[model samples]
Target: MKTISQVSIFIENTKGRLANVCGLLGDNNINIKALTIAETPEFGILRVVLNDTEKAKKVLKENGFIAKIAPVVAVEVSDTPGGLAKALKVLADNDINLEYMYGFVEKASEKALMVLKFDNVEKAIDILQKNNVSIVDDKVALGL
Candidate 1:
């Protein structure tokens, strides 16, 4: 799959705080392509992949949120069992460490997409291809 910028915003673990951040995006016309929220006892990291990452970053910064952007790979795979395992095995075989990941498929598409954050992207890509693992490209992802 293609590599996209993932913006992680650290927010206070309070009720409505997440809603507020999401509302801001809506108000600014930013569309979230995919999102995941990982929480710790102290705070929550809102990981978002959006249509306009730069604009989203600017908006978050202007609103006083601690945000960081990093590259992540999105891969589309079969929706059935072992799809995730197959992907994971490829990376494991090469000793690539996956920091985190999450994704889903459109109800219409049958194939699921996985957004993976790894330690080394280039190596990960190489390993994936060497193992015949298909990485979804930007064009394919955008349906271009």
Candidate 2:
């Protein structure tokens, strides 16, 4: 697992908004490691972990998108029933507040990727290490 810069974009809750934002990143060659869209009636929060975070943010901003960058931990956990529960318990024991989270598993794999937005990142990292939580780097995640 590793600490990555996550870009959160506030977009209007419309069909084409997501496509436009994604297209901008794609055009700039910023690979999205993980992404999720949490929508309400008025707006949507698009959380993205990108390979080129700065570039993505710049492009988004130039295109009139409201974006913010923050540090998040990308963890690779087992894709089992209690996998997320185990991780959440570790954070809870340390009193780390999880602001937001998103993830997905590789097709046909037992491993899953999780992006955790927490209150105290360093503390959370220490807690995870103390609890023997394995973190997958970019290379490890992509099997590169």
Candidate 3:
């Protein structure tokens, strides 16, 4: 629900390319908090919410990977039925449109973190705040 920085890395859709990215990050001590890959026929877009986004981008670019930074929203919601529905409903009611989103469950946790991309980030954050949603900024999201 709060705006955060997301790094998008475009890499070849071939074996070892993903490993190359991971190795590069690991070697530089960059930590990935959340990640999702959108793959097509020839290429893949790796979207990552990281503890060190600028460094990650630098590492990727130095290694010849196409990397860019963008803003996204991260929300922590209850890990139960209708938890997502309620959050989405708030956005829908506020006329906010989500371009895409991804998330993961924390092992042995009762909450899930969802990373959201939207055309209207500030407006979405405001709405989410008023509704009492757990909105996290980039640092907070990475810490989670």
Q: What are the Cα lDDT values of the candidates?
A: 0.82, 0.80, 0.83
Q: Where does candidate 1 clash, by residue pair?
A: 1-135, 1-136, 2-136
Judging by TM-score, tell me the better candidate of 2 and 3.
Answer: 3
Tens digits of lDDT, candidate 2, 88-143: 99888878898888884352246777878888888888888889887666555544
TM-score of each: 0.90, 0.85, 0.90
lDDT of 1 by residue, 46-140 (tens): 99877677889999999999899998887877889998899898888779999999883342156787788998998888888788876776545
| TM-score quality measure for candidate 1 | 0.90
Model 1 residue 75 distance off true place after TM-score fit, in angstroms: 0.8
Output candidate 2 Cα RMSD: 2.4
Model 2: number of backbone collisions: 2
| TM-score of candidate 2 on Cα atoms, chains taken together | 0.85
lDDT score of residue 140 within candidate 1: 54
Q: What is the lDDT of residue 103 in candidate 1?
A: 86
Predicted candidate 3 versus true structure: per-residue lDDT over 75-140, tens digit per residue: 988889998989999999989899999994242246888989988888888888999988866556
Top candidate by lDDT: 3
